[model samples]
Target: MQTDNSYANTFATDSDAELVLPSHPAQAREPQWLAFNAELAGQLGIPESLHTTAAGLGLYSGTELPDWIQPVALGYAGHQFANFVPRLGDGRALLLTEIIAPDGERFDLQLKGSGTTPFSRGGDGKAPLGPVMREFLVSEAMHALGVPTTRALAAVVTGDWVQRDEAQPGAIITRVAKSHLRIGTAQFVAHKITQGADESLRQAFADYVIARHYPLSKDRKHPYRALLRQIIDQQAHTVALWMSLGFVHGVMNTDNMTLSGETIDYGPCAFMENYDPNAVFSAIDRAGRYAYQNQPGIALWNLARLAEAWLPLLAKSGESQQQLIEAATELVHEFPIRYEAYYDQKMAFKLGLNSVTAETQALTRDWLSLLQDHALDYTQSFRQLADTLETNVEHFEKMQSWAAWQQRWHKLLTLQGDSDAVVSARMRQHNPAVIPRNHWVEAAIKQTVASGDLTIFNELTQVLRTPYDVVPLELSRYAEPAAPEKRVTRTFCGT
Candidate 1:
């Protein structure tokens, strides 16, 4: 694969700005390789000539670059929870270079947990083994579930320990993304505008985003407005997919929201077992701001920040500033409608209906109500719907309400004009049989972090790859919900 440095070479600052500075890892150790996603590497047309042993993965973790590569730490600002922070950037990460595949697709090859940068902000620039493994597992699982997300290219243990709560093994994950442009990146640009930066800078960044992710927008009558609409649409569909699979992104900060709409940060994310709309797993979310049910709203909030940043570009064609804000605000308001539409369509498929309507919506809502009221496992409930159709038995025999719901669902399926075979096939296609269940993820993390044994980690990662397929009985344990005591009530950011 070829490489590009457009972002570092064009947009990034060379000065020692508040959010941008040059730094390197305090220590780069031999990689105790845990995993490398060869499937993704193959798709990117990564040359086999560049392949290295597990221990050699550490070569990518340091400041020293291959002759063809140039590395830069990025700068941005984000709303931590709901409060806007003026500056936050690549505190412990670096954008090594943008790799161009044989197909001409560009992907940002970045190092997470590589080391300290100017944005480290007095904190250690490192990641523990647990979060590295968690990101690797869930990001790949999201891909298998057909969600667009940043893919994990490689994960290597740093063979060093970092103090977090207590001492834990340090590791680095090579994260691959279409681009690292976040809403917060735009926010940072807007901050610059507030400090008397020229409109030319804002337009340059907008042009860069259009070229990288939304090429069609460059030809539009008002490209900045077009870019905002495209981003809003992508984010709407992305959050809807997350909701369909019972995934909760514990932190929905602006910095964590990607312009490409791929789920970026996997820091405190989790998949729900029980179907509570208010489910929150991130320990730092004291007020449930980023709860499962609130994702759609928070996503819209983040997009509004992106819109604010692009106002200058939007107003360049002689439109009044107020008129531009009104137009962009109106577009942001449409996010909820778009998100709900996607959610309805996804839920309809999961309920074996080809189209959504008032009746189908009620059917879906009632089913979710049953799951919530009875505290039923989220993924299993939908997966079991197929089993119920086949055996004519209620999977949850104790929930009499489910039997009644099933009768209504069967009638709706008939009204929808699909045969049992067609509907069953559709439901199976959308409802995954496996997710990275919290308890199972915690178990795997324990094995690797506490004992340095990868047996459980390897097995779980392999099983999650075919999330929608029927698995061998030997791997059936992964399909089961955690016992009451085994549930992981909360997860951390692993900062």
Candidate 2:
């Protein structure tokens, strides 16, 4: 990672105009990307500088790309969301390698839009610039806001065009993450139980996750059970964090779910504006299956498939897999309680409440009810909670529930012995004043394509980088949704 000043200096493109990608033939002139990954023999910490040398480009300036990418397309099976889809794997993506950081922790460098694979499923395996930048910006934003996510290492505009809806140029994003694999990968092997390689595959998958993520994940022979429990807890919080932030992950398929529990796929995803739990933004998500409120359920449903994959390992001699199934069932069933508790804690922090309890759930519900009535901006209300000193509710037209919630909030702070300053500080930490609102992003995208002027895009990126901070007045270009004339109801998946 480079210093902020240095990164800013490098981000400037006018002086180094030719150094950056320009408006040209995207399809023919695009660079053919090469993978830098871990080798099959478990060679680790391949310095990134080697990749720059191989690519023969200065896109990284003096920085380097990792060496020895043991690139492999992992095999997996998933339930799409809830309904079982028998076969699903790395259709078009590839997990390049695991980078062992200076601290000895590993993160995956997976390439999206690189090229097609055996699992192409009759679709072109390429990415456009818009979605590439979207993943980079939003993933980094999530990281800054204390959410675990795959970091975008770099975005390269492949000067090639990929035809989906329109003929658009292709690009590749080097996404660094805790891991590229999912429980679905494990399920892919487990579901083929009759193949006799089932047990071998399950053991290998468990070992891989433990070795890469939780070195201590397997202290005992049956640590798979423990590892499974740990993943359940992490995924619970991850989804709740997404919900708290008003994020709608257009596609929450099994293979898209990461084993390390970070928010992974960004295709066709959008941030909500007027906060509807049922809001569907993905052009492909005609049904509200993977909606905002539906995220947690979908997460658990995906986890269930993973659990089923682990059933063979859980089943012992002649007693049958149901014993293992019962144990797995218990773990999956715990998702709601974990989610609700985590959600309440997150919601409490958003509202500046320190001493939250079952009683406070009423106040929280009432606040959301008011939010729905007023169609308030979800991000704004929590961000403004601390700033507003009025005892009565006058921010919006409605006042009854707001007034009551405010009173309860004030009372809770007093009971918890916390000052207004402390509560405000806490609220600011949890509540982001701004997100990559759909309308603003769409406008920025249109502006870039229509005029090739990246001023609005760059400005929004700046605001998004510090999502928790208040946006400046000059940056108000990103503050609101597009009016009736500019609204984009559907977001496209840059396939």
Listed in order, each prediction's TM-score against the native is 0.96, 0.85
Each model's lDDT comes to 0.85, 0.67
Alpha-carbon lDDT of model 1: 0.85
- The digit string of per-residue lDDT tens for model 1 on 33-148 reads 77888788888887765446433364455534566655577889999988999889988888877889888899998888987888888978888889999999999999999998
Candidate 2, overall lDDT?
0.67
Top lDDT model: 1
Give all candidate RMSDs, comma-separated: 1.8, 9.0
Which residues of candidate 2, in runs, are more than 4 Å off?
A: 1-28, 32-67, 81-83, 196-198, 316-320, 390-393, 397-400
| Residue-level lDDT for 252 in candidate 1 | 96
